[model samples]
Target chain A: MVALATQTISSMSNTDIEIVVDDPTAPEENSPAVASTRVVDIVVSLLLLALAVTLGWDNWRTGASWDSTGPQPGYFPFYLSVILGGASLYGLGAAFVSRREATETFVTRAQLRRVLAVFVPTLLFCLATQYLGLYVASFLLIAGFMRLVGKIALWKSVLTAFVFTAVMFVTFDIVFDVIMPKGPLEAALGR
Target chain B: MEAFGLLLHGFAVLLTGKTLLLMMVGLVLGIFVGVLPGLGGPNGVAILLPLTFTMDPTSAIVMLSCIYWGALFGGAITSILFNIPGEAWSVATTFDGYPMAQQGRAAEALTAAFTSSFIGSLVAVLLITFLAPMISTFALKFGPPEFFAVYLLTFCSFVGLGREAKHKTVISMSLGLLLAGVGMDTVSGQLRMTFGSAELLRGINFLVAVIGLFGISEILLTMEERLALRGHAAGISLRVVLSVWKDLPKYWVTLLRSSVIGCWLGITPGGAIAASFMGYNLAKRFSKDQESFGKGRIEGVFAPETAAHASGTSALLPMLALGIPGSGTAAILLGGLMVWGLNPGPLLFVEHKDFVWGLIASMYLGNVVGLVLVLTTVPIFASILRVPFAAVAPMIVVSCAIGAYAIQNAMFDIWLMLGFGVVGYVFKKIGIPLAPFTLALVLGNRAEDAFRLSMIGSGGDMKVFWSNGLVGTITTLAILLLFWPVIDKALTSVTRMVRPAKA
Candidate 1:
């Protein structure tokens, strides 16, 4: 299929013959909304428009006019907000109208699943940072990924995570003397 | 003759045991930071700036500056080895660098990159040593209008000349501008876009945003595969390194031209990332092997690395000669200077000739040291690529989280970074170019501030940008560049008509 498409593209310069061909279809995979560029564009545009309204309203409240003290704080920002809304609206319109990108998928289902596998863990790690502090949270996060995603041995993952977090403690906490967030473990250790 | 003498004295001061050891330490730290995603040159310097607070300002600054050098050199390592840009400027390096790694010429590519960077930084430092005093005298005449015009040119150049989805570029830039405007409206002392959230009060930090966008998004992208780091494994030897060296001089024109671009843009506020972009574009435009650029061309790696290093180093020239910082890292260094009782204006040249000359001398030695150090370490850094993707990806996330948290010690920033990462991933998935977004995020606030101040100075006259020849010419050129497609179309059509008539 790929080779045939390439051949057609190479022969495209010969304008005399008009070729009608459909792309070779594979079994359809379930698509996430993020996979569609059009869906993403519309969503992004609407959010930007909302941002414009919020900004424009705030600017008006703060007196978007030029007082005797020259332009108000919101004057320049207000105009920028307008441009943002305008550009985004145009984009939203274009997204719906564009023919070339009618069914183009941004990513396949498998790709999203892969991204989520890493992303969900990272997010949980961020939430865990508040409770466990940087060091403990990192240890768990690293160990989790190592054990779960990597399918490594429990001892190996624990050891690698321990060593990694231990090195970080020495570097940032001890050597650079940088003050990182500490949980109960650090507090008890008197670090 | 006098420069030669000053340079000798500078070297004399630079070779001290404490300074030499400190410079090595700086290079090591830089490599450590630069090879990691999220931790960047500016952030690395900012983090270490406090360590220098107790030491002698000169020695402290020498270490800090060497870290910057290390970080700049370090960026190319990861970009080539792991397809991650540790620094924003190294984005261009990944174009051909990863391909070279895939082709098993990783050693050759890395050698060219480091050597080209050395040449670029060496040329910039040399230019600074001789031309700084004179160039700064000319820079004193610049006003807000001129600054605004220059910024307009840069922003427009990205949006106009670069072949990307134009609307996407505009949308990305607008998002950046909007993000930058959040927090406080400093001009009027009014809060805009804060939505009354305390986190919004501090505004979004560009570095944190960068961490999320490049570092986190890259991890997500890597996951699509079963995830093992891959590299070209012909391996680094003295032979390959020497072969790259011998082949390097053939592209001296690219090296020289990119260095010049890096110097000019660095001295201006266009900065390292812009310089790299301009260098890569210009190299592509002029190269005989244009098609080979993103396909592992050695020259592609050289163009951006050299230009980025040159600009990253020479950005100091403006900070020393003028009070203005030409780059984010330079600004932090300037803040450090002020804390240590050294003003960074013209008076700095005379007030502390030893310090200035020593710093300059250290740039020379630092690049040499950095190149030698990083070249030796490339094998180790590259070998890390042999690790399974699952282990490495998680490690990248944790380090990125720590790096993000280390900036403000706020878990909120990490959350924000995660948001940016997802956005970055989606943006890439959709066809949005990130270079313009990052540039706008960095420079948008300054450009907007300059325009407003210029307007205030001119009593709301937009023509203030054209009031002086310097500003006017820049404004004209910016306008021309903004409409370059139309101008380009008209010119080409005219040529087409003339050729047919003549034929």
Candidate 2:
């Protein structure tokens, strides 16, 4: 169960390098909790604080003082980073002291599962588009989501996906002539 | 009267076959997007913006603004029938709209909602028609300090009036400013935060972030609840609309009050969501039958829809006159304005009178078109909601991906869009406001330019913002608004102490 939860979180996949956690209190399907609101709050605020510090350092290095022409490029961003850092600190402090939030679930396990179930597939669809092309990847994604998550009949999902992808291709590629990524299949078919 | 001549010229510009066809197409597409769960005005506008890249600026704006009016009308459909707000601003509509639907008055509720929206938009357009030119004329005199002060007030108002936590709003806004500063610095011609990536050189496109934040993140959020969109059946015949129109005059006070509230909020940064809730609450408070509110009252539907549409329409006024977007969708439209090689702000009125007046003219015609289209097609849109979310969600995702990729024909944008989507999901779940983030991102560089220019002019003096009376007043107002939450609490506590002593 812990491994499954970790896998789900890590499924963010090429989206970012945010920390992933294995919450022991991720709860059962019946219980409505994946992590406490306090924990998520602390994590997010800390992440923001880190971002603020990094940005502040970068802006400082880039020249944050006023020059002859005007304030330097980094002057504005440096002050903005300061505000961001201060706000993050305030958020962190508030989250730590807020007892009411400590009892609340950031997202229930069932809700997180539902969210991740769609998100992981979406990330994969984006990755797959690089190799398989937009239309093919989209067709597979829609069909797979419909069949697996929606629990629809196989033929219905396949048919729906095909029809949808065909309409999109016509609208974009044929009608509007908006250029999109085409793959080996389109290359083989010539133009 | 000069404004009248300009508006007539605008109508003449709009009286082309191609423009009318685009209007109808935009309305239909707008309604379709609005009826869906995850797609709203901002997302719809962002997704379709690229399609207008080659069109004339006047026609493009007309079509895009028509989509906005259509979305405003379409939001009422889901709120009335499905008890789900298709748009965030329409959430208040579900209070009485869904109740009326449950009482077998879905048609009546939807008709009232659409009619009120039409009335609201009409009033706002009238305000814009007469007021925008004058404001722009006044804004023509504004210097850099004044522009910076105005931008300061715009961002400050979000912190002051937004419902989110103060710190979260600050964090969201500053983060956007940071992101906006990532690419090449326009004045210095130096990279600020690109690190070393080649893709970062072009900067993060607002369109991609919009598609990801509003479009993709919305889909992910919708998936969290496993929606079953079993909704009330609605059949809006002409008779139902006529009856609703006849009954509408009885609640003229609610209509007028809501429209006023919407216009005020829309012109400020209070926004459509706040306007809707305030409109509903005030209507309920002022009504004799307040108890009937939230239980199937037609006035309940009227208040929120009217205010939402009105504010959503009027939010464009500031964007036109001052180059400051009053809402998220308006911000995207501002981005589109830049993409079309037309500068926003007061100069736009003088330079691109045709485009400006043409858009104003379309706001009038488009709302009428939207009202008629929605009244006849509510049933079709409501049924469209009956389609399974699983099927619809993926299609929306694909459209979003296409929108992102189409920005610069870059695959990197698609990946960046996915990243922003995850960020959006996390931010939303943690109650970080997205509106300020978007507005800040769109307006950040412009504001920085104004600030730096002011500093340059004033020899890096901090008092430059307060050097002149006009700039000083605006700067003071911005600071007051930024600290309004604290000041308000202090005043309230003081009032409480005084009242107790008097008692």
Candidate 3:
């Protein structure tokens, strides 16, 4: 069993309590998928603060001042970085003190699963494109999604994905004449 | 007389056979996008923009702008028939428009909504026609200081006037600016923030960022919500339209008031969302029959729809004249403008008269075409709302990926897009505002350039922003807007003490 992290907090308007949870998505029972808003706010602000520091330090190294020709490259950006750092610190402070600190789920578990359901396949599709090319990659992606997420039959998924990919091939390849990435299979056919 | 002649020539340029077909196609496409869930005005436009890359700027802008008009019309259809707002501005439309539909007044509601949209957009177009030249003319005289003042004003106004927390706005804008600095600094030619990656040298493409932020993130957000719509069925006929037309004259005051509010908000960075709410509340507050508002008052529908369309149309004015986009969709349009190698601003009026005038002409024609098209296709679109979101999500994802890849035809951008999609999702989850980020991403370099130019011109003295009266007043106004919350709190507290028994 996956260890679940659960918290409850008031909403943006303090009207109702929302459950914030982090649990693996299980089709069998309810999956606590949403990350806590407080967690997200603090983490994002920290990342922003980190970015501000990096940018500011970089500016300092590259002459963040005025010259005879004009201001140096980092002149304006240095100030912007300082502002970013300040704001990020403020955001960090406010996130802890926020009204819905514990309960506000940035994204629910089911939502996370759904997003991952799309995101993971897209990543795979991008990887597949390098080897198999756009048409094959897209067909596999669409079919995989339909079967996995849509819960459609394999044949239906393949057929629908095939048709969609075919239309795209014609529209982009034959008519628009835009070049698409191709693989050995596409090269097996005549140009 | 000069403006009249230019408009006539604009119509002449716009009425070409190819442009007419393009407008119709764009309208159909826009309505389809609007009817679909998980894709919004800004998202749809940004996703569709790259496909028009090969077209002339005039034709491209005309088609894109028409799509914008059609989306405005389509938003009301979803609101009235499905009780779902297709765009943020359409949220207010559901208050009465949905109620009217529930009362079996769906056709009447939709007709009134579409017609009011037409009127509102027409009014905005007229305003643009008369006012754009003057505004552009004024802007033509702007130097680096004045330009920087305006840019600062825009940034500060968003931070001040926007409902988001000030810290979040600052963080979002700063992040955007930092992201913008990742490319080759055109002025110094010194590459910073490339992280030793060759792809990073080109900077993040606005089109790619927008597609990921709006399109991919929208999918993620919707997958969480899984919106289900049970649409109201209504007769799509001329009789219903005529009945609505007959009812429309009575709410003329509402229409006018909402249009004015919309035009005002749209020209500013307040956007259509704010305009619609303001229009609805003001109409409610001032109406003789305020009691009937949420209970299916036709004026309720009239107020929001008119304001939404008016603001949607007028938002383009600032983009055209000052090169500052006032809304998300307009920001996407500004990105499109930049991609097309057409520099938007005061010089556009002088340099690209045909493009400017033709776009204006299309606004008039597009609204008319959009109104008629949406009015007749109500039942078709209403039925489309029933299509399960599961079937649509994959296609959107695919489209977004294709758009991202197509921008540079590089795998790296796709990776960047995926990264930004996650970033977008995280931002949404954290309640960090995306508008300031988007605007800052698009305009960050320009603002920086103007600031540096001002500094150079004035030997690094920040006083250059306040050198001229125009720049000084604008800069002061920007400062006030940025601190408006604090000032407003202070004044209101004093007022509370002065009139303790008022509440």
| Candidate closest to the true structure, highest lDDT | 2
Residue B52 lDDT (model 2): 82
- Position B177, candidate 2: lDDT: 90
> How well docked is model 1, in DockQ terms?
0.22
lDDT of each: 0.77, 0.87, 0.82
The DockQ figures for the candidates are 0.22, 0.27, 0.22
Q: Candidate 3 residues A50-84, lDDT tens each?
A: 98998888887776887789888887778889999
Candidate 3, residues B1-503, lDDT tens digits: the string is 67778888999999989999999988987888887777878888887786677788999998888778777787887888778798889999999998988787877888888898998999999999999999999999999899889988999998999887889988888888878877788799987777678998889888899898989888777666535445445655788788888877788899999999999999988889999999999999998778888999888898998998899999999999999998889988999888789997889999999999999989989888888788766666555554435456666776787778777778788778878888898888777889989999999889888888888889878888889899999999999999999999999999989896775
Candidate 1 residues B1-503, lDDT tens each? Answer: 67778888999999989999999999988887687544578657755665665578789889999999988888888788767777779999999998987786777888888999999999999988888766656765768898788778766766776666677777787778778778887777778878789998888877677777767887776555433233332335678788988888799889998999999888765679888988999999998778888999998999998899889888888677765567767766775786587866666777788998899999999999988887776655444333445566677777777766766668888899899899988787667767567667666677778888898899998889889889999899988977888899999999999998998
The candidate 2 chain A region of ten consecutive residues with least summed lDDT is: A1-10
Candidate fnat values, all: 0.46, 0.54, 0.38
- Which residue pairs overlap in candidate 2's backbone? none
Global CA lDDT computed for model 1: 0.77
Model 2, position A97, has a per-residue lDDT of: 99
Query: Cα miss at B396, model 3 (Å)?
Result: 1.0
Tens-place lDDT per residue, model 2, B217-329, is: 99888766545545545567778788888888799999999999999999998899999999999999999888999999999999999999889999999999999999999
- TM-scores for all predictions: 0.78, 0.94, 0.93
Best by TM-score: 2
